[model samples]
Target chain A: MTPLDCVEGKGLACVRGGRTVFRDVGFRLARGEALVVEGPNGSGKTSLLRLVAGLLPAASGTLWVSGGDIVIEEREERGKLIGWLGHHDAVKPQLTAAELLRFFARLQGTRAQSVTAALERVGLSCAADLPCQYLSAGQKKRLALARLKLCGRPLWLLDEPLAALDADGKSLLLTMMREHLATGGLALVATHDPIDLEAARLQLA
Target chain B: MSAFAALLARDIRLAARAGGSAMLALGFFAAVVTLLPLGIGSEARLLASIAAGVLWIAAVLANLLTLDRLFQADYEDGSLDLFALSPLSLEGIAGAKIMAHWLTTGLPLTILSPLLAVLLHLPAAAYPALLVSLLTGTPAISAIGAVATALTVTVRRGGLLLPLIVLPLLTPVVIFGAGTVLASIDGLQNGGIWFLAAFAGVTLPLSPFVAAAALRLNLSE
Candidate 1:
């Protein structure tokens, strides 16, 4: 463990609609660390990821990022620090993969150089020019993966990060996760399957 | 590009290429205007009398045609999540979408309304009035509709509810918009235009924030 935590949550209580998904949940992660969140269906894996990403208002608790509480930080600045990958791949059916990545890259204020490299990293260079609707299930996942790398954010909140992937795609995700951790980034991933990585585990159920 | 400009430009391009908010709204507007004469048995004097009100109603309905889909596609494709989590505030995002909606749907409707007014026997003197009224009024449609859009963001089939919630709120705009042209035709002075401008002013500054707040509420739902 480092002397300081990258993300420190204390007594996070999450409620989706009328149901309380989790209560008094807390965890601390350091830079260059990946915390793998494991939970079965309806166990609040997705809810937890959202709460940390600042997408959902916690019923009660404080989530601190980079030693500063997220609530105190302006939403835009807090948003700039975290990258979220949800289940629904945000692939626009009408837009070509390159165009979508370029748009998100510009939206994220990421360098243009990262767009091409990110596409290539996800093995999407061949399919970058194709409209998103034409890409297969795996390719769409790759496109979402490219979006995560397109930003220069230090924190990643990924829900079910390995849902639809072939062996090669799975390996690509692993490589990307490794690279992100090596650069002192924090990735909090929600996954149902076991993956090879030296990551601290957070079990929801 | 900055997030604000990038979102605005991307949405406009998307509307032009794929979503076709322009074609749908304009086509609906034209069809409604075109059918008025046929349905009413081609009474020239009657058409002239009802021209401003009929065309104004058409404009409102036409604008409503595309309002449901404003946030539907983005919400479906998970882009809303990205937008919510981005460095862009929800208000900023809603503002960009309103701008884009005005460009593709409202601005075109404004430009075309004058021509349609002529088809409805609008007086030549009222052309400037119709044009200016539509130009000023449609932004109000977009601004108020942004709130409707955000509120309906989570509804699966928002078609019916979209108009139901919005039509009542926009009653004053429709009334004032038609009043502007009608006032011009009557050669009388009324504060119709000032009312429309004031309505737009209120809607433009306030609706985005209301829409953004609503979208946040829907986020957890």
Candidate 2:
């Protein structure tokens, strides 16, 4: 049941904009565990997450998720097992929260949830019918988090999940992470702030 | 059916709910077609000669206007990344998006071309030829536009650059499309439809893969 056993990376490097963001970076996460990637603004935390999520190629090493090696050949299969959320809330502004969640659920090949349940999980139940463009900043972040609840994937790659949250929103997210890990789901969250989790720290310098 | 249907349905619903860009594109197409005959002299022979080219050109422009939104909005909102990461390959997503684009922009343009043709004083017999050529050519427009849209997703001023990149590539389509209608008007239909069909067939399969690759490069950047 070791988290590292299920998720692992080795000698991973990423370059962007004619500069090497980080090189030889590596880490792992497992069920019932969380790995917090702490770094400064330009320290390649998001790049590392993208590499792990198989969104970008690693310059040098390999990433493995849930016992599957993340080579080019296994990318499609690996994608199904990873749920990634970046700092930019990717929700379509024209879509109601309900429609957005339903579309994403179908994309992930999962049954659509009661939008009520998903929205309520992120404290967005009252705004479920509202298009995302009209939601407040924190509300938008919550709407993005609601995707995590809807997809129910085992691995979560979150970049600064707590950036725009108020205190209550942060607490709600912390609780969500605990619940996720308690259920044998793993999370790799990249952030600057200290997250209240009994989690291992992975510093990307 | 296949996952392609699901992707198409989702995009069409998204497009429909978002103020119906397809119908709006058709409206633009009609407006452009109507204005051309007014701008130029309305002599019957002149209109008949230029009608197909004008209609196809207007349709291509209208399609380009809506093309930027094909990937730009999705990329801005982060749904493009999600689509990229889907179990469906990027090429599959590109194909679905192109189909949606054609359904929204191209199909309406083709449907409305005949109406515009009449207003432009085009010969009655040329209507069917114009329609057939548009049916074959507009998909190529959508497919080629997808490649440009994907390439310019991360670039600033992509809206302006879209047509600049795509229009040159659309030369063959315009040539064949306009040629087909003119040939019909001249009572010669031997090669135009086949040429149009061949252009569509070749571009449809090839453009999606190129678009997918371009999107991957843009995303990775």
Candidate 3:
């Protein structure tokens, strides 16, 4: 793990719908680290992750990710460096689980073989040929995580990663995340659920 | 496959599925063209004279039927958010979808126009002109409709607003498209086809940028 691998945001402020969502949010995480953001409802936990993912523009502060071979400064271009898991599963009902993963894998420019591996990793291999509309909600969350894994980005911006996850799914995700951190990847997770990970915590009220 | 091709293939597959709206557009186009003669009376000469215009109008409206969902479906499903995060530029994503819209709606409508024109007793001499004009002009319709769809994508129940914004912009396409067939019927050499082609030429290339800009606004907000 390169010590240079990390994400840093300083005095980050976000405005949405003509109102400030959050302000002066700052954090720095070096390689093999995770930051858990805890907050009440409407406290902008999701907004903070979105801000870092470059999906939302910072109204007041500077946000940048430094690590890997190249540094990303542009907000829009930072998506190339992030694997985002928002509240929405982003699954199409018409597509089978395997097809869904393959599509995302292709979009991520990952190898074709990774689709099968990701499905297996998420315990979705048996249902891989089944259409997503038939999959349960927790299964869908697993599918999203599999997509997150397929992205292979060094930084993960996961929003509510624990939502709708069964116990097995939860452990599976934690293990995958731990593996990610072990491999020099960092994560900023936004969640209400308390997780068991040796990580930094940031609270928003 | 590249992201553009992956998105394009998925969209086309969805449209081909049952209740995908692609067939709905084609069926609506056929029904409108078929029922028009019954409403306007069975005067063959009159039908022939207006066939180009009426079919063009039906084709335009039919192309519009499926447009509202172009970006709305992706946005609602949150695929669009992920797409924005992907390596593909928003402009490239917009372009691929515009092409998909053309493939499913515009291209199919073009193919079906002549069959419906037969019901209107359109002069066989103008058939090639009708095909060529639609081949050139309907792409502009798809392109322009894509931008309109993207602009209204964030609005709940935006389908009702789509035609109001799109149809007015399509006046020239309908005019030049129908005019090309009309001119062909009269054996006159007019610039109608070239104008139609030029309109498509301009809008097809420009819609991606305009739609991408709209998408950027909608996505960030």
lDDT of each: 0.85, 0.83, 0.89
Docking class of 2: medium
Query: Given candidate 2, what's the lDDT at residue A113?
Result: 51
Model 2: per-residue Cα lDDT over B11-125, one tens digit each: 8877677576876787788888878767887788888788878988998999888888788888887787777667789899999999988887788788878778888788888
- Full ranking by DockQ: 1, 3, 2
Name every residue pair that clashes in candidate 3: none
User: Model 3, B134: alpha-carbon shift in Å?
Assistant: 0.6
lDDT of 1 by residue, B1-221 (tens): 39999899888878787556788889899999999899887777899989999988998888888888888888888898899877788899989999999999889988888788878888877888888888999999989988998898888998789888999999999999999898899776588999999999989999889999998888865
- Model 3, range B21-122, lDDT digits (tens) per residue? 789999999999989988989999999999999999999889888998999998997899889988898999999999998999989999998899999999
How well is each residue in A1-205 modelled by candidate 1, as lDDT tens digits?
Answer: 1122478889999877688998988998888899998989998989898888777888999888764433335555667778888999988888899999888887877777777888998988998888888998889999999999887678888888788889999999999899989988888999899988899998887
lDDT of 2 at A178: 90
What residue runs in model 3 are displaced by over 4 Å at the alpha carbon?
A: A1-4, A68-70
Best by lDDT: 3
CA shift at A153, candidate 1, in angstroms? 1.2
Two-way TM-score contest, 1 vs 3, winner:
3
Candidate 1: TM-score of chain A is 0.93
Q: TM-score, B chain, candidate 3? A: 0.98
Weakest 10 consecutive residues, lDDT, candidate 2 chain A? A64-73
